[model samples]
Target: MSEENKLSVLVVGGGGVGTIVAVNLEAGGHAKVTLVLRSNFSKVSRDGFSIRSVDHGNLNGWRPHEVVDQVPAIGFGKPGFDTVVCCTKNIQDSTPSIEELIRPAVTPGYTTVVLIQNGLNIELPLVAQFPQNVILSGVSFMGSHEPEPGIIEHDFEDKLVVGAFRNPGTSAALSNARARDFVGHYSAGGKTVCEYTADANRSRWEKLVYNATMNPICAILRTDTATLRLSDSIENLVRPAMEEIRAAASANGYNLDASIAQRMIDMDPMEIFFKPSMCMDALKGNLIEFENLVGEPLRAGKKHGVAMPVLTVIYDMCKMLQWQLKAAREGRSQEDMLKVYDSGKP
Candidate 1:
């Protein structure tokens, strides 16, 4: 496509991270930016989203060009988007709207989809539904949150990694060029973005290794990542889980560095204090993405014959908590779920 024919980008999910990407893109002069939010978040479009950050000081009073609760079900009107960035959660079973929004945008010659979720399961399903050539996987280490409606606080500096899946041989030039453009824009906003290996599974699994060790433990214990980093009890549990994930990664032919956790722990204390998003979701009683974040790794471990006893235990506990939460929502008891969070005592 010629430069004039390149359609603008649309970002699905108007939460903190989504807002950051949208704002930064606009700030970088990418004028044709549209944000598609869930019906519940439409109010943000009118009220506008605000972002406050220690790094950038504060970013508020910015508005998106177009905001809708759903993708244009009637098809992207007139000027179709050349790219769609998905910043939705990773819960495989609860993402129909995200799927619907991405479907039309994946038409072969147009629209590359960039996924910025936390887990590793979203890509396969997307590729199954569309073309692998059009899919891009991205990982962001940025810290952010919504203190209230129309307000997002950026808490930390984050590096972003973008790349394509393996052996698809589908427009590598296009993928790399887009990734470079995205990184440049993010960097301009004082965020770091880079190109990772084409081996997305390895990069994804490496990230999952960290999340599996940190996110759930923080959620179950109800603590910040820093506190977990400092605790002997949490560290004890986490080390074994990391070992299991490392073993699984090895089994899958990906060699992870031994110093990953130490590097993470060595980061500034303020950065460490940033809480995992899952903890935030649990606090709001939102459904957790247990399957993608926890369950998939467990399954992969078993398939590879790698032992992950700690992860298995944590997965079972999280699953039970999720079940109880669902049951309570349907008029059952939440005492058990509450106990899991309390007993672990992170």
Candidate 2:
């Protein structure tokens, strides 16, 4: 496609998932991909990306159309992004939220926002913030990780479920049209699969069977899927958490059957050894997505008076683990954490 005719796409979070998205979109010869980077900005911009994958075999020095560290302002005669795909790790009510982080690049009524992160009802803030823009809920079921700067490893399935995020905010016609458009760009390379859904929240609830349970449990245990599946954690912790999630989602009117959790658990085979993103983050001493994956669901359960005892325990454990991570990163001791606690400050 020519410059004037091609879509301008800005992808935030140039990690494993974002890099894959940018590469696939750029390779498709459809849209112009501008990638936003964080810690790995300096190295990636200079040498580009190096990917070792099960799908797109061994990509070297792969760069997008434009690589930017900071998001460019959308207006004032500069061409704004046609779509912004945020594949970042979502923390609930974080400072400088995902909406604000990507706000400057949003062209108000024009730019469509696509969230390809994990969580339940994560689109609420963005929905409230940018009511005019088309907000897409991208439920990604891929496993690609960046162990070091500029190197990505993809071994899991590259599948995406794309659709309108929540409610009937934008016209149904416009919502479906934009979702199909993104699916077109995303699935251009035959290596990946993308599907469109009218009710993306349902997809999210289904995915929570894995995300809310296996993801957090694996992280807390600091183990891989094979280990977790074999251990007592799967029966004692994982399934019950999934049941709670199912109950909460059903309470909110998205009804998923009881078999869904067991089906998800059986989907991945036992022999294929791999670590989910949360576990990897925990082992790497980086902050894991505790709130988005676990905390928010608990809150929802509380609001609806759903019994989430299993998830409540998991949430508290993950919360302490996250707190310990932060304290460790700052070189603070557990006693120092108690100081903050004893002072009645958060």
Candidate 3:
């Protein structure tokens, strides 16, 4: 395709996943990929990005063709992006919200917005606000993180399970060729494998099976995956929480298999020792990803009348931990704040 005919993709948030997508898409040499890096624009634009992928090996000076501070206004009769991938965190009550962050780039019928964030029901508000846009869901299994600004360390698996967010019991949005084509861009230069499912809700729910259990457990206990796996926490805390989430998903009309809970339990023995994002955030005195990860599931359970007692307790602990950690950041005594937990109070 000519430069004018090439598909344009704008990736918001130049973090780990955003860089991965931009680098791989640019590698394909097919689409015109641009990155919206708000903070690290000067460094990345000058020196480019660096990637240390366990699967793809070390790559230095990897840069996309275009880097801008913000989404440019789509001029009248001027072409807008064909795809907009959001890699930003969906923290609870975040400013500029996810919708406002990407609102400027959405072209309704033209742009396909792929949400590659974590948690449940993260797409509902966007779907409601931009009903004309082709919204797709993506569950990123890519084990990657940014240890420093403008650098990405991708370890272990690199795969994305993606599909259109059709209503429950509805067929996949395979008919949306744009969604299929967008998925293809991820693996354009063989960077990662992208699997398209007819039932994206199943994929999202399946991922929550692991996330709902591990994220809060680790953040609250100040532990890692290996710690949970090696001890009775797997059975006592993780497994029950996963089961409750699975039940909640089922009650919300997404029937996840009971075996998913066991699968997460079983896989813990072979996986790497690491802390989840929520745990890392808490340790670093950052805001916890409260709403989507735990709050949404709990509310869904209540709405559907499904009992999620174990997850309820975990959720409560996470809220308490969040407040205590926030106080610790503001020069409060960590020891005294921890005493709040000692009292067995919320």
Candidate 4:
């Protein structure tokens, strides 16, 4: 594609998932990615990004087409993004609401918004806020992390599944066309794998079989996947929770195979000590993604009258632990976790 034909893309979220997407798009030369960053903003903008990946090899001082801290509020006479790929964690009612954060760069009828995030039912808030834009649902399976500022380590091959999230008052043609265009640019480099799915939500539910089970268990247990793999709790704990998730998905009309729960566990490479995002967040005292990841799905399943006893137990612990982390962040005692029922306490 020529320079003018290149897609104008905005990437928010600078973690493993976001960095991989930005670097690959820049490498492909099909998209001009303007990455909005935090934490590593100074280091990356000054020295560019130093990336090490199993697929693309190691890159030193690699910069996207445009690297900015903010997307710049857009209005008449101002440009907006052609595609906004939000790779941030789903933390709505958590902090830095993705809807408000990316509002400035979203053009009502022009910009195609892609959510490369986790958690079930995460599309609703963005949909409610940006009803006029074409929103695509994306799910990524990869092992990548920023071990240090401006330095990325990607050990697993990145794979993506994208499809259009149902947008009210928008034609199916427009949504599907934009999703196809995104896959083209994403796969132009031919390094990472990007696949198109007719129903993006099925993929998310399948992924949640792992995310809602293994992720939160590892967080609550304060262990890594490698450790869990070696433990006898696979049948006793993890798989039961996963079965609940699959049942929950089925209750909601997304029928997953009975084997998906076990497949997610067996697929992870044995050598790597895979620390999921929730586990890492717990270690760092950050807010665990309970609401979207566990809470919403649990509620949905219960509403459908699916008995998810194992998952329900996991959800309660996740919410309490999440509260403790937030309380600690606010300098409140962990003992105050139940005080929320008394009055306005956080």
Q: Count the backbone clashes (under 3 Å) in each candidate.
A: 0, 0, 0, 0
Question: Is candidate 3 or 4 superior in lDDT?
Answer: 4
lDDT of each: 0.70, 0.85, 0.79, 0.86
lDDT of 2 at 307: 86
Q: Give residue 165's error in model 2 in angstroms.
A: 1.6
lDDT for 249 (candidate 3): 88
Q: Which tens-of-lDDT digit does each residue in 232-287 have in candidate 3?
A: 88888888888888888888888887678777766544456788888888887878
Error of 3 at 41 (Å): 2.6
Per-residue lDDT of 229-304 in model 1, one digit per residue for the tens? 6678546887778778888778878888987656554443645575677777777777777777888878877898
Off by over 4 Å in 2: 167-169, 333-346
Model 3 scores a TM of: 0.88
Model 1: which ten-residue window has the lowest total lDDT? Answer: 263-272
Best by TM-score: 4
- Evaluated against the true structure, the overall lDDT of model 3 is 0.79
Rank by TM-score (best first)? 4, 2, 3, 1
Which candidate should be chosen as best, given lDDT against the real structure?
4
Q: What C-alpha lDDT, on a 0 to 100 scale, does residue 199 get in candidate 2?
A: 88
- Candidate 1 collision pairs: none
Candidate 3: Cα lDDT at 214: 88
lDDT per residue for candidate 4 within 66-119, as digits (tens), equals 788876677888777789999988764755588989999998877999999887
